[model samples]
Target: MLSKEELLQYSRHIILPEIDIEGQEAIKDSHVLIIGLGGLGSPAALYLVAAGVGELTVVDDDLVESSNLQRQIIHRIETIGSPKTESAKASLESLSPTIKVNLLTQKASPEVLNKLDSERFTLVLDCTDNFTSRFLINEWSVSNQIPLVSATAVAFSAQLAVFNQKLQHACYQCLYSNMNLPEGNCADQGILSPVVGTMGTLQATEALKIILGLNKADTSFLLTYDSLDTAFQRFNIMKDPSCSVCS
Candidate 1:
């Protein structure tokens, strides 16, 4: 049952045939854990909060720097020196006071992953730009049987994927069997502002679809986008029987 305020707040969603009041309620009861507060995480967090996700946990240890202001729109110029987790929480809370926000102002470690109450969260979003954190989140989510939405963007390209243990879906390791690719981040390689925003928005949309039970097919695939050519490509992925993390 939606309160008067909730009903009004999610009126747009309530009217959608796919996401009626029941779907809106599911979103309001769901929890998402975001592993980074950078470009991809920024828009994903903002949209999730706006869509009425009940609880959000942001994990990041970095501080807002001048260079991050272009795409990390969640943090403002005034928050340049503040911790990323704190800045993201403050901005999200201001956007939707009804949503509960949690801040983990520390780097995510195996210890932190082991301590998390996976049952309390419906999904995990891997917005981390590094391969190490990406693999860590994938391993933990696979072991805990939690669905994960992963996105990464650099320069003009981005990738999005959804991994779920319940469906025997492919994990990150399944796609990138080895992490031998050259390491490059936004700090080293400049990124177009809208590139990250587009990827993050898609990540949020996928998360919402999973939460609302609006998606009936397995979304266990990879979506690639190139802003320069405005081309979107999707590659089908399957769980690798020899996957080191999920197998």
Candidate 2:
């Protein structure tokens, strides 16, 4: 049950027919895990908290740096040198005191992933900047039957996809089987601030939709966005028969 304050706090969400009181309640009861506190995780965490996800666990081994503030909106000048997970925790708690934000100020090592599997999370958001982390997350999500929302951004382009093992949707490896693909490293190349923010927000939207069981009718697709052109494109994502992760 939501408190009177919470009802008023989420008035806009409750007013929506697609996300009425029941949906709002479901959101409030959901637990989410967010990996990486960089550009993508920043907006993803903020929106999920604002949407009333009851518990959120954020994992990031990096620290706040001057370079990151350009896209990582969840941190501030005052938080420089502080662990990203701690900084994100402070920002999220300030947004919704009722929401629980857990911080793991360590790397997403295999051991860490194993520990996370012991708990039940409604879904996971993979906002890491590397393909290795993305691959590891995909493997774990597939093995544990958890839904995963993954996003990547570089320069002016961004891509978003969701992999739900429970639904038998295409896994990450199934979509991008080649590990030799170019890394869209913001540090190496460059990234438009809004490009990552836009993708991360959509990641949060997809997560909520999945939790509300509102994604059953939507066909599997990968969404690509170009900030320069302000264009969005969708490509069908099908599971690979020989996919090592989900096959």
lDDT of 2 by residue, 45-105 (tens): 9999999999998899998999999999999999999999989988999999888888898
191-227, model 1: which lDDT tens digit per residue?
Answer: 9999999999999999998898765666488899988
Identify the leading candidate in terms of lDDT: 1
- The residue ranges of model 1 lying beyond 4 angstroms of the native Cα positions read none
Clashes of 1: 0
Give the lowest summed-lDDT range of ten residues in model 2: 213-222
Best by TM-score: 1
Q: lDDT scores for all predictions?
A: 0.90, 0.89
lDDT of 1 at 156: 88
* Each prediction's TM-score versus the true structure: 0.97, 0.96
**Candidate 2 Cα errors over 4 Å, as ranges:** 178-180, 217-219
